[model samples]
Target: MALAALLAAPAAHAISGVLDTVVIMQDVTDSYKWPREQLEWNRVVAQLQEQVHTTERLVQRADRMIELMGTAENAADFSAPPSVMTPVNQAVRLETTKHAIESSRNLFRLGSKTRSTYNPANEVKATFEVAGATETRDENRYAHFAMQEAMYARYRTAATHEEEVQGAETALQEETLRRLKQVKTEAQIAVLTASLAASKQRQDLAHQKTVQAKADLDAFRAQLTTEEARKQEADREWSETVVKRMRDKALTAYRRQFRAVGSESN
Candidate 1:
């Protein structure tokens, strides 16, 4: 009877070991496959990232296109229409970029750790601290590259718009001078002078309009620059927040795994 009981004990231990392996395997699989709620959050985050990247690239390209249009001598020609198109295009692009950013922010808020009632701030701080101790320089390099590209593009566009306005004014002046050369008699000169005065008045009005437009453009560009800087800072903060949350979740899972292993050993 003692020999039979001892033999049965080994069989019972083997059965328990098999059951434990199955339970652990199921837990690991479930852990790896995120819950439906977390999966939705991840999807939102991915979408926001893609939209932000796309908007950044679009703004950058628009800036370059505006610059390239500005550099040509005949940019103010009626056929080109760049004077009106450039600013309008930039305004549209900027508005689009702004919308994209706002949308991203909404999605980020929706998917944030705070939404889960998780204490993300401490985790975020720790993540950033770790990143700072390790790969901060690399992250900064990429960030600067994006920033420089956007700045150069914006500057080139603004410069181009200013040049276009100047060229248009210069052309109008030359036209006025050429008309004055054709005057002969006092009557003709009087008519020409009156027409010239009117033309000058019109040119002055146009110049004023140009100056106002340029001012508005400059203001818009400055706003964009300020917004971009704010966005960069926000992105770094968000990254830190995400890292902290992930680290906390990972540690929790690690502890659970340790406990499971210890139980299996017993």
Candidate 2:
């Protein structure tokens, strides 16, 4: 199996429909029911988090999208966007996804370590210590060894479960993608329209927050710069003088004066 395929192997708390990730990079306007749309949206978000490794940009992008639509609800309710908004905001959707993926890749460079740690027992090395040595352990060590064996058995069980999930996901991938891309009925379009309207309402509420966040970020950056400069000035505030030195010499200099390092033996 590919290294990535192995690392992101199923975990106990993993979300369902997550492996339905083969998106058709198209200008999608399918009239799927709001609930199904919601499911697909969630799957995309979950997959992005898993594949890319972080959700900072996803959150930011979601915030931005909500702001654009002029409603608070869109932030949490992605499946049902406003029907009045025609053609769908493909740029926003694709850009948000691209940014989300990129941010995760950068933010979680060490994600593999965390992934391995999830199955801690399975991560055990073939040659780990027993009584401070790898080979020729005493009889007393076997109990400890046996305890580890039990732990490893649990790991094996977890691995088996993961493999089953992977197999199921593999079978479902194509079908899920096709479902997402399929055309919708008139009734489905009506539902989608309502979903879109709700989404737009949420998008409307998001704009002011986005503006406020940008302002806050700038202010924080400026404050940080000013504070850093003040810190540097404070570091140089003390004078390096003979009178000052006499009153309070540094510990290293004091140690050097008292100890003859080259000639000393403990």
Candidate 3:
């Protein structure tokens, strides 16, 4: 009986494992909406990244092709396309035109003013200048009043409730003192106290909502700044530094191969 029970236990454990796997598979197959949305979102992000990468590669290749097109080996009248062009020459001209289009798009999108490379000292100087400017102080004051007015306008209910809270507190304090001195009705004092409590609760709810909104705004700004910095770093690395290093590596390899071929022939 003991042997039979032990054998049955192993079989039960195996069955339980298989059942769990089956249930997991069923859950996976039955799942809809959220997972699909998540996958679609991921695909969108991936496609955006891929597009950026392809654009960068295209720009780099176009620049190199333009340089090659200028040389004697690949010289062709790109301006006069009808003047008998090899397929490769025509392709080069097409790529160059595409590069020009991309360049124009970038110029318009980024504005005509060329951005200087990042400089810490210049950044600090600019920050200090802005900080010291009279306009900055004026703007700060304007922003404060504008924000206050906007808040009051948007949250009229909360503002009204806050006013009520203040009035209730004032009435409670002064009325309580007068009632004590005049030996006024205890019911009146109780009513005033309860009004204050209710008003205070309403004020606290409004304050919580305002605080949460401000916190969310601050977090969003922080995230935006961080992402901007990351993007700048990535753009610099990919478009300039990495490209230069790759070009140097290719040149070095070519030189080594050239030397090897010369030695072999000699």
Candidate 4:
């Protein structure tokens, strides 16, 4: 009985030790699991935070795009004064800018959403291993990507269009300025021509008046010459008559004196 008790005591101690080792191992495992769970939770939180940051950036970009659109819209209204070409060119530029912004917004939205749908491990890995790797993915996802790519292409095209429109607008403004200068020069020339014409007309009127005055002066001079000639003829006639009468009276006196002398002598 003593030997059996000794052996039984050793067996009980061994079982207790084994039970304690199992409990310790379970405690260690629980502790490790707790840390791993916490780490995983932290990792998930970090990922969410990164996603939030990305979303915030996207939102900011969208806001900037909105501001750009508003600016383009506002600039669209100020193109009326100079020329028809200017307004048309400005309108085209603004519209192209607006379309480019919209395309960028669409591309950003598509890229942001594509992260959830595209799985590289499932589709890309499968395609690499398989020989006949026909895409069995959802058509909508491919369509989405294609649409985003199209939007990006459209954005580039719209940017090019905007540049072209801006160039056209600059050329139009220059042309308008040139045309305005030409019109001003033409107007000045017309005014000078009118002034010269008026001066010529005034000179012609003065010449005509001078000619009429000279004619009147010549007629008065001719009338005075005719009157002087008639006066001279009347004076000559009166002088001849007076001289004849005087000579006849002298002859009669001499004859009377001679007759008286003869009678006295007889």
Candidate 5:
């Protein structure tokens, strides 16, 4: 019996050791808390996604506006000026007078003593004086006509040149406005493009953070599951220990009863 008890003692000690291990593993002293950081990261990811969406919408709007501008015709700011009859008549008269002056100048260049002696400045003064008998001086006829024609030509040339300069300036201003508008559109598109790129980059970073957060949350859940399993194993081990003790007591009582019965029969 002592030898049997010695073998059973080692078995009992091994079983107790197993139960102690289970109890140690099942220790749940630490309290559970919500995964706030992980949840907050998820929320951050959602907000970033919304920002990316909004930026994409703005970029699309900018692109649509650019397309419309490309296709749309610009209305003229002002109509072309109408041809004036007065300017046309003045041009024709000037041309006729210019030819007459050229012919008179050629004649004067012939080195005639009378032509050399004729002073054109004096003839011009006399023509404008309003008190001269101009018809009586047939020799000064060419000089007077040349001077008068030259004055008219100068006036008409100045007026025409000024009109041309004004027209050129107006055209240059219109072209400058058009170029400025184009540059503004280009700038807007470039800004939107850069914003889109930045938004996408932010979204990617947010997604990476969210993934990492979720991984951490999953690891935490796994740890909780392991702890729960350990608790269940500990409970099972405790119930087995109770049953073993009761069985041992019942066996001892039956053995004693059998020995007494045997003694009585002898």
Candidate 6:
């Protein structure tokens, strides 16, 4: 959108300048002034003016949209902006814990449900653990993606801010040029001269705002990476420890039951 602002606004002035030049040249070509040539320049000038005006309006709309996206916050408390992609920073992984006490016995076995064919109690419990771990991982992942999106939003807003400053400078420059092209009082020229200097200072401040936004984004991304890694690793360790204990207890019970049955057969 900002790119459109840059290209269309300048073309307007260039097109108008061409039309003015053609009109001046026509004054010296009284013998053979092709009416079509001057007519085409006039049409081009009209089109360019409309394009410039439309683009300027769109830029204004962009600014309004940015303001509406979020309420103002203190720079020191720059938390997450209102986002459709809200991160579950602290997610609940209780499914695995709930299913950890599931019962399993060989008495319920039948054809195709033999030990090798069906999931054992420990295995079912492990499946629950795996599921919880996967969800934990997914929650962390989306959290990271959301943070990155916020960073991108800041970058995009910064870029738009710079483009806005450029647009203002362009308008002031065109105004100054127009005044120079025509007869103006000394006071009128001085006013424009002073306005141009003020515009330059605004441009500098806008540039600084853009730079600071990008820097903030970079810092946030680095911090997010560290936090995501820590969460993933902690969940992994927990899943592994719980599942291992569940499997070991199931195995020990099976071995003791097999021995008692062997002594009875004797």
**What overall lDDT goes with each candidate model?**
0.51, 0.44, 0.47, 0.48, 0.50, 0.52
Best by lDDT: 6
Clash pairs of candidate 6? none
Query: Which ranges in model 5 have alpha carbons more than 4 Å from their true place?
Result: 1-191
Higher-lDDT candidate among 2 and 6? 6
lDDT of 2 at 2: 90
Residue lDDT tens for model 5, 130-168: 466443323444454443334343444545643543444
**Candidate 4: regions farther than 4 A off:** 1-191, 259-266
**Candidate 1 TM-score over all chains jointly:** 0.25
Error of 3 at 263 (Å): 4.3
Every model's TM-score: 0.25, 0.20, 0.31, 0.26, 0.28, 0.33
Residue 103, model 4, lDDT: 51
Best-to-worst lDDT order: 6, 1, 5, 4, 3, 2
Candidate 3 clashes between residue pairs 3 or more apart in a chain or in different chains: none
In model 6, the worst 10-residue window by lDDT is 84-93
Q: lDDT tens string, model 4, 119-223?
A: 655332112324766544344434433434434444444444444444554554454454445432333434434444443443344344334434444444465
The per-residue C-alpha lDDT of model 6 at residue 36 equals 70
Count: clashes, candidate 5: 0
Clashes of each: 1, 21, 0, 0, 0, 0
RMSD versus native structure for model 1: 50.1
Candidate 1 local lDDT, residue 192? 46
Better of 1 and 3 by lDDT: 1
Off by over 4 Å in 3: 1-183, 236-241, 248-250, 253-265
The list of candidate 6 runs beyond 4 A from truth reads 1-141, 180-186, 229-266
